[model samples]
Target: MSTAGTMLVIGATGTTGSRTTARLAAAGHRVKAASRRAAPVAGAEPVAFDWHDPATHAAALDGVDRVYLIPPLGDSDPAATMLPFLRKARDAGVHRAVLLSSSAIPEGGPAVGAVHQALPGLFGQWAVLRPSWFMQNFTGAHAHARSIRDEGIIRTATGSGRVAFVDAEDIAAVAVRALTDEQAPNTDLVLTGPEALSHDDIAALITEVTGRPVAHHHLSYEQMRDRLAQQLSAEFAAMLAGMDRAIAEGAEDRVTETVQRLTGRPPGTFRALLEREMPVLPSDPAVR
Candidate 1:
């Protein structure tokens, strides 16, 4: 709403958080970019913030009337830390809050769902953004991206399942509107890309666009979970594998207009994203 009080953005160094902070600052709104190191972010002030450390909460909340919340990464029960900080935030005069959530997780479902459930009651003006899988997963430092780069393979338990992978920039746009609009969405919004694509479709698209040999390797749920366990907690690995299984069951096999409706522009396509982020080989005649 009014650009009087500052906006506090947690996880300011993250995908959507960084973009949100930059957009806010570019629009001339005051922003406090919160990260563990309190690293400087362009166009915003840096502040140290840790979800588990309540001592970092008050300082981040000071002079902040609105907040963009990015829950602790890999925390299965984020509500434990987030709820407490949220209560403290409300007490410290924060009125509007926008929470980042996932499309697979419904309100009160599990993981960040618990925080989503508590948000409405905590702030009079609030919005919960439930976005689908990010398109950047295949281009950035995500495991999928690593595998694609190293082995030219994308492994997953989701066999033939499709996802409407939205862009992090689109999610950030929606977050900005939710945080700055006079009237918050006041409801959970499920954001998705314009089309639903299976992992096989993604692999083919990457191969064609980048002129690289890429393939999707289907794995059993147990296989995927055990592989992920090497890098993540057993519980978290299981949860991620379960999500893949759900995708295989057609849980995420749909697209939505949420991004366009909120941002007044179309969501980005996977092909477009790949072309923009990946270099096309000179040997590929399609682009040459």
Candidate 2:
């Protein structure tokens, strides 16, 4: 609350993590940005870190009282890799922790769930961010974005399911508040954009914004799983497709005011986000 000590941000180069670190640093907060490579983050100290390697933990935690927890990517169960460092952070007197989780994976559900369950007992102050599907998934290096850019198609197993896709910047803003606020929310926050729309709606929006045709191709769960398995393990691929199946069942079709309540502003809409980010899509014919 008083904002006295350095804040350690794991996954500092990642989507929300980068934004969080930059925001914290711009606010004049001392920050340690930890990633696998030691690269400078604007207004913050950068350090090399890896979840699997415990040896890189302490240096990052040194002199830090708060942390931003971004779980290991591509790991089905990340708790096994993350808990040990968290335990050490607790012992080292880190008092506040903000974990970046997903709306699809509820607290105590699957990947980062175990870490979410263990947070309350480990630290005096903590918040778990369960953000809906990120809006950036359609514009950034995400698989969907590549498909949209090259093939003019967005593919998923979520049939007609709608999602209130949130923005990474909004999530970072909330995480900054959780780390620095005089009174932490002290509970898991479910963050979303102001509206819910299906993938078809997103494709339509993109088409309108970019003046290029875009389509959402619905795939069977098994088809999606098989497609994903070409790049990922079978188990992880099935898990990802299963999340889409749950969305198709109407799991992620809700909006929340948590972003507004936390950041004193409304969350960014999918259309607005597309207008802002779509220009960055490759204009080069070779990219298509």
Candidate 3:
């Protein structure tokens, strides 16, 4: 007998993907948490899944009625890289596919948005999560977090511009709904925090929440690029610094109500997110 709605979560170990996996399983859905490593998850089946390999696609799609598309890393165009996988998912009986995309990158960009473009023709249903820069970027072992904790300074080309900085957990909540429910709007969901806050505001928030003397350290676009180049490739450094430049230009300084509409509750406030995640961040005062 075929399961009517077997949900498959791609990139099951990632931040949002892992949360979605747990949420779906808790709902009593038969979830197949797929990954290249197939890490174990309670109340769900772990299956082998690799975006680059076509031969293993069918194995992951077995009994999968819906899919959460988290594309492989690197700069390759996902529209092309993951198309065959999407096609195979459809052929193997997957109905809907929810894609994780970026808020900074506009629709039809060279990467995730490409998957956003291709999924409609390749599947029965689709939804794209166009979320802003994550709050987790500051709370996790990434550039933002390291800079704040180690240097007591945050460097960015984004001058004093604000961003809505949505939380990945919120993104997962929206994704879980789109995957299991029938009423998800078949379009992009621009998930954001309840309000936008400048990088200065962010530094202030941390100082207030943690009672630490943190500060926003701003730099010119060229200077920021040069500063980051020492840590990453010139090309990669430029790409990341360019995003800061965009934010400086007011590209991502706004709020939206989509999170509430889609997930049926207000998106987590930046303060709320900080409160929940503060205890988890490493206590070392010097980690830059």
Q: Which lDDT values do the candidates have, in the order given?
A: 0.92, 0.90, 0.82
Better of 1 and 2 by lDDT: 1
Model 3 root mean square deviation, Cα atoms:
3.0
Top-lDDT candidate index: 1
Each model's RMSD to truth, in Å? 2.8, 2.0, 3.0
**Decreasing lDDT order of the candidates:** 1, 2, 3
RMSD of 1: 2.8
Tell me the tens digit of each residue's lDDT in model 2 across 1-288: 474589999999999999999999999999999999967999999998999888898898999999999999899989998888899999998999999998988768888988899999898899999999999999899999899878888999999999999999999999999999987778999999999999989988887788777889999999999999999988889999999999999999899999999899999988889878887343334422
TM-score of 1: 0.96
Tell me the lDDT of model 2 at 48.
88
Off by over 4 Å in 2: 280-288
